[model samples]
Target: MKTKKPTQSAKQAAVRYLSRRDHAEQELQQKLLARGFEQEEVDEAVALCQDYNWLDDARFAERLLNNGIAKGWGLLRIRQEMAHKGIHEEVVSHLFEDDEFDWFEHAREIAQRKYGDSPMDTDKEKARRLRFMQSKGFDFEQVKYALDVDDDEY
Candidate 1:
């Protein structure tokens, strides 16, 4: 297909999108294309946004990571959300490279917020809590840590 040449209007649209929130380049490209922009126009618009530091996937990823952590989301859920928003794996990976994040403590906090810190009285209750954490996208170890379930208990 013959793509139309780049245009200023596409860049304007890109800026409008960026003014609302930082966007991954791929996400901005797809939005512009969906709005009837040609591929070349979308590419130019994306590049223009990048040139102005308006659209940056790494920034988007970092904000997403921080937001997810604030919302008590596990790494799995955060990663999935970043991917869905067209964030690159490299960007996502870099955000997770920080070892200071205590995912276990975060999971435990989420658990306490949702289920309280009451000690489990039954094996069934422990399993149910474990399943709930898993549903929230926490890994097995983190979930166990949140519920304080020992390996021998399962």
Candidate 2:
């Protein structure tokens, strides 16, 4: 009878975790380690996954960017989230550089949906709107355009 190999167990555990969603290499390693796997076993599993093209940080970043956009998240928030997942800044910058979506337009739409079509009439209201957009991760320019621009200005 053959004993269960540690590397095989590690690989199986990694695959199971990956089945639910894509994970960055560091993220996967940490998860496996947290699950009580030895560092050597986790390393072997990660290497095998990478060899099979099953673990790719670039692919994970791309998917994350797309998903964040679909969920109405701004670039700042998306980048921060990706960083938390162990994605490199180079990958995040590269992906964002190629994206042509009008962030201002998206911010405007989100603000309009949350507040209304009417322009902010008071300093207090404007401040409140600005805070809301900022909380949603929009930069100052995007938030200003969203809060200050009239529908006809577009």
Candidate 3:
């Protein structure tokens, strides 16, 4: 028997997902598959979506980066979100590139915006702020720079 083509509903679901926001190919496929669509159908729908320029991982990844930065999220946090969404490392690297961006400066701005010129007077408060910065995904060095935490400060 001849192979069956992907159904219209699969294509419709793919478009509907894309209509809301950009989705990575793998993410879209997972969504469709989770919706009870067959693997073959999801595969074809994803391929069609790519062909129609409706699904673009690079665009999605870039949007994530821009949005994360706008929200004062650190590079690590943004990259983790992208990876969770199934975006490839190559796609992420394409947008991030090298050390052209000053992560420490960005982290510093976020820290200053929240803590201002007044330093946390207690070790407890300082630890809390450091934990918050870590949750925001900045590395130790960046967090230290952001908080201006010299050894004597502790």
Candidate 4:
């Protein structure tokens, strides 16, 4: 007689992955599939997770948004990241629709911390600062506001 090995079920794999952190439905689904689980099994596992409220895109989006804000990320960057993670557009938009957080103010604070209170003197210096802000996922308007805000305002 040959000894048989017990294989891990889709639910088992999914639960293990979820233990580490929250994951978007699509992200979890992809991860489960990549691990060599059958497509139907992966789908059933994902559906079960969703039914049990173990997988919530809204919750994931909220956590991601809050984390990005804490990290001083601009709205554009945060939005892009959430989208890439497969968060629903409605969830992303709803989180950003609140008027409590001021993106412009956030941009100014980030700029002050990065480049200090001193104004850029040369075009080259200004360009460099602009590039930095752009790389941070701020739009041109926010970047301009950040670069031009008076030091006395701080």
User: Which candidate do you rate higher for TM-score, 2 or 4?
Assistant: 4
Q: What lDDT score belongs to each candidate, Candidate 1 first? A: 0.85, 0.84, 0.88, 0.84
Of the candidates numbered 1 and 2, which has the greater TM-score value?
1
Instruction: Give the poorly placed runs of model 3, Cα more than 4 Å off.
Output: 1-8, 151-154
The TM-score measured for candidate 1 stands at 0.89
lDDT of 4 by residue, 39-113 (tens): 899999999899999999989998988898888888889899999999889888877777488788888899999
- lDDT of candidate 3 over 103-129, digit per residue (tens): 999999999998888868888989999
Worst 10 residues of 2 by lDDT: 1-10
What TM-score goes with each of the models?
0.89, 0.85, 0.89, 0.87
Identify the leading candidate in terms of lDDT. Answer: 3
Backbone clash pairs in model 3 (N, Cα, C under 3 Å; residues 3+ apart or in different chains), count? 0
lDDT of 2 by residue, 1-154 (tens): 4433344488899998898989999999998877777899899999999999999999999998888877777778888889999998888888888789899999988887898877677768777887788877788889878777554433
- Candidates in descending TM-score order: 3, 1, 4, 2
> Model 1, poorest ten-residue lDDT window?
1-10
Model 1 alpha-carbon miss at residue 39, Å: 0.3
